[model samples]
Target chain A: MEKMTLSSKTREAQSPTEQWMRYLGFPGGILLFLLILYLPAGAGLSAGAQAGAASFALALVWWVTEPFPTYVTSLVLMFLLLVTRTSNAKAIMDVLGMEVIWLNLLAFILASMLVKTRLAKRMALWLVVRFGHKASWALLAFLVLQLVLAPLIPATAARCVMTLPLMIVVATIYGSTEATPNNFGKNMMLLNLACISVLSSITMTGSSANLIAVGLIQNMGGQRVYYMDWMRVGAPVAILTMVLMWILGQKLLFRMKPEEQVPQVEGGLELVKKQYELMGPLGFQEKKAIAIFGLVLFLWMTDIFHMRWFGVEISAPFAALLGAVIVLFPRWGILSWAEADIPWHLLIFSAGAYAGGLALDDTGAAEWGVRMLFGGMNLKGVPFGFTYTVVISVMMYSHLLTTSKTVRTLIMLPIIITLAKALGWSPMSLALPAALCIDWVVGLPISGKPNVIMFSTNQYSVGDNFKYGILTCTIGVVILVISGATWFHWLGITPSFWAVAP
Target chain B: MKTLRLTAFILLASVLAMAVDLPTYTVRLQAAPDGSGQGIATIALAGCTPGTFNLPLGFTAVQDLRVEEPASGIRLESSERNGMTQLKVTLPPDIPAKATLKVSFRLKQVFQIVKLKPGEKSTLPATSRTFKHAFVNTQEYLIGAYRVEFLFPDGLMAQAIREQLPKPAKNEVGPRVLLSKVDGHQAAILQFNKLQQGDDTSMIVELVPTRRSFGWLIAGLLLGGLYLFKFKDLVATKQP
Candidate 1:
């Protein structure tokens, strides 16, 4: 139902009904948030708890349909949750403090600074110059830049935000409207670049979901999946899937040829230099924020090596909040807390996510869902492969239906374990692959955090995102199924604990 | 008058959607006597524990239970009394010592599914057990004075040997013995002389507790709002 770009429908601006929806959504959202946040506070409240959880559906629905900023809605919900004594401020906040949410905000701020300084644009310009004039080569370079940037910037929306202007730059230099071959080449280079950049986030560092999983895993108090350790397994799988995505995109996408001459941007880097000059004499606080960000990265990197000495450790969320305070308080300078303006929606959605997960637990709906899918296998005597295939396929298909990657993982992991236990089949056959492949689920533009942020800009249409996403997810799913399992099997590395036990 | 009526209608609709009340009903179990020094027959629901309802009730469940040295003649019973439907169980005579039975049920009225939007779905999914999917703890069910009957072959008379028959050896697929009626057309029902485990068996039956849908209207509103907001992006074709 969503069209090509996010703003495809919003460009003309608000309508009468929209005005009413906005007003209604705000107060109504507050009311709904209250309902969701409260109502289950007393004892013997299973139904109430479940209803409280299910009411979150209304929050998302209202946010999407109404005129209010979604993040503001998130803030409202958080306050209500605490105010109603639905959960302690500490407990609700713990979910917000989960690494993924903070990492996303930190990354957004950094990307914002980069955009403000024109640093991202200059880099894009330099990149285009270095890998010039050849369709395949340009696409390849774009792919490389995306892969490199994804790790540094976990927010897909941030990447699109920082680089979209550059894309427009390239598209303008080549083809502003429709394209001839050269324009088509730039088109291929830029659009595919955006798509691949989004695709690259399947790895933990590149996206919020992976970090969320790591947080949950750590919170679950078992294997402390280090940033680098996650990268250890995640990087290779992500890279392989990305490479395959490029080949498929070029083959399935277009036949445009590269141009002969490169864009002469001898003077483009000046904008960044001018920005630094215009902003002038960076203050102690700016320097401090930068220092803290650096320290956070250092801690994130070193955490894996000395998980003991350096471990007990710092998370990206705490680090970002620390940076925000340092920038706001220390030796007043270029930036202040006012500038940080951390979007509360990120935290709100994260809380909603936490609450949604609780509801699934409360209702036993998730188990009921998967059991129905696999229930007949033990009775109807379905073939083991069919059973595995059905389970695996369902895991893959779930991406199309839902956007939250962790929710899919939560649902899939338990079902796979339960089904494997029932059918005497190996669990890794489902678990390992789903974890490795969950990021590859690109069916809709909004499937992951990056996709959600990308949609916010309205540069690309929903249809475009859906089309591109479905393409990558399909290709990525097949590649992971074959290469991922084969590679893991060959290395004698089990994808899951159950597989080893099974 | 029209405005008042409209407001009242709206208020009533909202109430119906949001209201939830405590469910009233009690779980009741039934039994009989059997031979091989014991007696047995199927346990049937005599009726609701208290006041009945007009509500439709039936349970469906599948479970894994293992019974040892079991003599058949066990029956799980379900029926209606007054206006409400009831759930009950019947046992067979001469249930060998240590015999056990496993039963699971899934209910229809209690089963529910509603569509969700991207924003509404949760990361930690719900663990749903269908009413048809539940576990019964038999060892927990057997206790004193609660008569469990075992149905024996040849319809024989009272043998103090009844207490001598080992508690129905748990043969799980619902404690086994072909559950055939012994003589006197009387199926030997095993009366629990004394429960090996606890007599109070707590079995959780999952039912569809809530039914509500919200995603579609939201999607419609989002699209409609977006369409209205970006009128320029959506151009009209002229009908020449």
Candidate 2:
């Protein structure tokens, strides 16, 4: 194992053409901003809201192309809103400190603690060694391990990094090195990437994109989707997807050799065991970190129960912050301020995006955009089942066109909610399911951060990802549709196709 | 001869009551921290004889209806007609002249988180927590006065108050208390002397964060930090 710096692993040098394309994003955003501001306001939207629409457009362009750092784009968007009087300074500033932002910050801090305490490494090794008797079992072991780590580590990329070394070691043991990749290694790596990305959909705070989607839903006059509700709707689908991916990878997609069926390398399990032993033993810091996070998870899952008994509602973000504060407290805490890996860039981007969403809703720009884009479709008369299927499919396949999950969510969710409302359907029925698709960024190498990171492993080609990725994505869509119609129906999330609209 | 004279006087009083109009009713609402409220409706019938008094409530499931008047103890019955909950108080046969009735009951009140428009600034302090309480008019007749006093939760300080209604005289229930506002609603804080009718009222109150939450936050961080330092070696890295 080698020591790795976070930035060095994630950052790649840009090509001249790519750099020029990124530079184009700035003027492109400015042009869009001016175009939206000058366009004739219709549908009874206020001028302030129209201006807000301009800032949202600007942010969208920059977010998609990355002319500036995502956080810098966020800051620029806020400043534009202030200058254009789209929103007041207080409102803009207040958003930066919102509880959701803190939640993301806290989640990052918790992830950092896990990394620093070496708890994640230890947990991964123990799972692999315990479940690595057979090739199929080893693959399932990694799949299960990634799912377990999904909720605890919010960043998909971070999870990939944590598990990558173990994966390489396992591949080497099977004689499936990167240069001569075997069916087993391809299956393991591809499934590893796919499962990590897919599992993020199950937890409310599993990914930053999920949080942004929730925020957009709340901004659109919908009730907050708590942790329990998200899990109930998303977890079954995620589990089913993982099952299908495993079957496809093991039997159908990647052909395994007889030698691959069992551990051929004598010391493979020893390697993992050695890594586990290196951690020495769980110390006080590990115990404390575990205890604090355990409390956080407890509070998050039982928020409603606690609210009933204690009269104070413990929101997901607040619970996370509570855990983070304890973990970062000086002298007794596991991490110092400098050690905490809070992603300010992502937070700033979120704050700006939230502000833009607020402006859109407040200024009636979203409503207007909804009217313009969907008004002529006559979607109201369409059958609920058909409408729902179309919505889910669009959300699933949209990953092919964009890279950033947050950008995808920020653009799609508001429109989806507005369209749902316009169609006289419940916003949650459409928006929440659509939001779940934010994690399905697996259609292409450039579709998501995790996909990109996995692609860089050199074990699989673009053709490999596209072939398997499309198959599983199609299967995932089917599973999601089934859940929306049956499971979601049972939960009263969606009414039966012929039932009266809510 | 005395008995005959008393009967004639009673009959004469009953006839006089038939000509007098119903007294005006005033409702005062006090909101609690847990989102429930207590309301007192005072009926002033200074010159009229007691008869069937009907009170319509803006909210439903009225509970604990306590009436103070009619020494014989009048029976109170509730019925829903035309989607409205009406409380019917049957006045005693031997009614007093120039009487006032006080009716108090408990009703559930909903508070919503305040939504600010883009670029709209809140008057509440940055650190103040806020919630909005709405008062709707369910009565058909004009109300003499509508007053509301919002009680802030303990450890929270009321920094500023905003109301939906215009030109309301603001006062403290004790000292330095503020209320919140809703658009197009009128409500008076701490004082109920003003006369308002038909229009709905809402109030928003901003409460400054108390040391309790801050203290818990700080204390939890410090304690957890200390615990980590004590057991820090468990996290020490070992490269294999």
Candidate 3:
């Protein structure tokens, strides 16, 4: 009961900005909504699109400000979408039934399996024993782990589920809890979050959005972006940006003092090592948990071959569901229904955010918004370097406004291709580089699936997230700009910056 | 018996599929000098049977509708339902599999007129009034390549314009989109490879009258001559 009370108190605790936002956020959202709604519509912007944009603006304000709980704000946004005629009733409600939400739900159950079976504790102890001497090394170790898993597990949420328990356990050992989080915990959790998102851009098969981009480039641009071609360009930019983010995060953003850098446990590294030794060999439950997770990972890794081998593809959600069913099976499974740790609030928040985003998409607001964005630019005779920089920046930062990477790709790539055709520049020159930046959805908790999962840990505030996220994004933009001028020019992905189209 | 039923179903499905095999669908919209317009849709169908097929003209309130299948010599009896023209084509039993259908109709309004008042706006003088011609594909299917040609009346200059995303603070700018010339008229052509059901493919362009440019030139010359006449003494005093 005391523990429950402490956790609840932690939930209620808000930062100074959060407190002020909650106070003013409600009226502020309404004012922004009215301002955008009644403003003179731009070209090609229908009334429906205007209303959709207004509704999305209000939701974003409320979400950032926490006028209510984030989930309640979502509920309000969903209602606003309906009443404003931005989206239909069925569409608003159907967001909960989306496959991403289902994947998150089932993933939480699998996450519970790892934690409940003591398997997570074992792995956490092992990680701590190996790299827990300093918090920086421990963070780097998880970073490496994410890089290794990014190519293997195409589903980012699945990777987060597998690693979330380890993060939590290791965080507690470093003296960070849900009730009381320290810089070590904040840096650890947010770094892993950045890694999962940024590393996905390193490979062509990193995410489904990457594949969609490839298809768009091939069909619309008539040029194919081979897997190796993507990795050749994508790997260097993503890796260098991640490393810079890691160093800057610790040294600058969420700085850890010398005392905080070391393990805060009573006995430190030796104690963590002893604890791992004390756990002894893998027990029945650990082995069972491993077997289940191993099978799930195998299925995830072999998704490309599922159609050829099994005649049907088991998507990420279904594969996780399969594992969840076994994990909850009668007496044989590792966890029971009561022991499963699923956060319905985050799921509701996710659903509402998605509903709001889809409303923007369905009402043609998103497309109109992108069109107006490019239409306003005077890139007629601009140098290729300047144009490339603007395009890459827009693509990298657009994740802040969108919820789904696939929707973003669908809307963005065509306009980009069209813009390339309008200009004399090659379509692949702009669209390919833009496609490489699709997975940089690391700006907010509502930005991506793994972000929501990581946010639910309550280790960091939204302010911390925005600061770290925006900084990381800026770093990524800078690296891409530099690379586009140098490395990409050498790679033939980009032509000379001063060269005019023939 | 099950196999026979399946075979029959497959054959019927194939025949129905061939009924709407629109390999080449072209729509040409011609805007006359009097703010009125006409639309001609030419569709090429392959392996079609004798049946009634409804073709949507994407305009509500159409006038003088005509439909003809040239190859099969089938005259269509038409009626309007749900904003589409349902044509009942009666083909002979020995008709060929391929056919070409042509439908022509007059439209209510093709362009919205924007008259420019002299000296009303500071930046752009009363040079030309633009007519905005917009075409939206209202069909609920993926149009592989929607070839639309907008032919303005002769001596009117046309430039296809594209709307940009919204900027709250900045002034509006309609960037010029690439257009092809069809018989000396600016033709706004769009390809809808990713168009989905209920999704609109809009092509917007601004048509300026060439005579207005000449009018502006005459006005400028008269103004310059008047200025010289009115300020001759002042100009001579200042010139020394």
Chain A TM-scores, all candidates?
0.60, 0.63, 0.96
lDDT of 3 by residue, B1-240 (tens): 999999999867754643434566677877777767788878776665654444455555678878743667756666666654444555545557877778887876676545548866532224322334323434433444445666666655442143311221111112223344566555555444333445444555554444322442354356445644654443232333
What's the CA error at residue B193 for candidate 1, in Å? 24
Return whichever of 2 and 3 wins on lDDT.
3
Ranking by lDDT: 3, 2, 1
Q: What is the interface RMSD of candidate 2, in Å?
A: 20.1
Question: Which candidate ranks first by lDDT, i.e. highest?
Answer: 3
Question: Global lDDT of each model?
Answer: 0.43, 0.65, 0.74
lDDT tens readout by residue for model 1, B188-236: 2322233343232122222211322355246445755555566432233
> Which scores higher on lDDT, 1 or 2?
2
Report the lDDT tens digits of candidate 1 across residue range A36-108.
5334221112332334343554555455544444454455555544432234457666766665566666655
Best-to-worst ranking by TM-score:
3, 1, 2
The TM-scores of all predictions, comma-separated, are: 0.51, 0.50, 0.72
Sort by DockQ, best first.
Answer: 3, 1, 2
For candidate 3, give the DockQ.
Answer: 0.02
Roughly what TM-score does model 3 have, to 2 decimal places?
0.72
Scanning candidate 1 chain B in windows of ten residues, the lowest lDDT window is: B170-179
List each candidate's DockQ score.
Answer: 0.02, 0.02, 0.02
Write one digit per residue (lDDT tens) for candidate 3, span A1-502: 0011112122443455555555566667776777786575443544455667888898888777664677887888888888665677898899999998999899889888888778888888888888877788889999899999999998888898789888888888888878778888899889999999899999989999999888877777778889899999899888888888888889999888787787677987888888889889999998999999998889999999999999999999989989999999998998889888788888888998899888776656776677768878988878888888888888888888888899899878877876776778888889888998899998998889998878877888777899999998898888888888888889888888887665
lDDT for model 1, on a 0 to 1 scale? Answer: 0.43
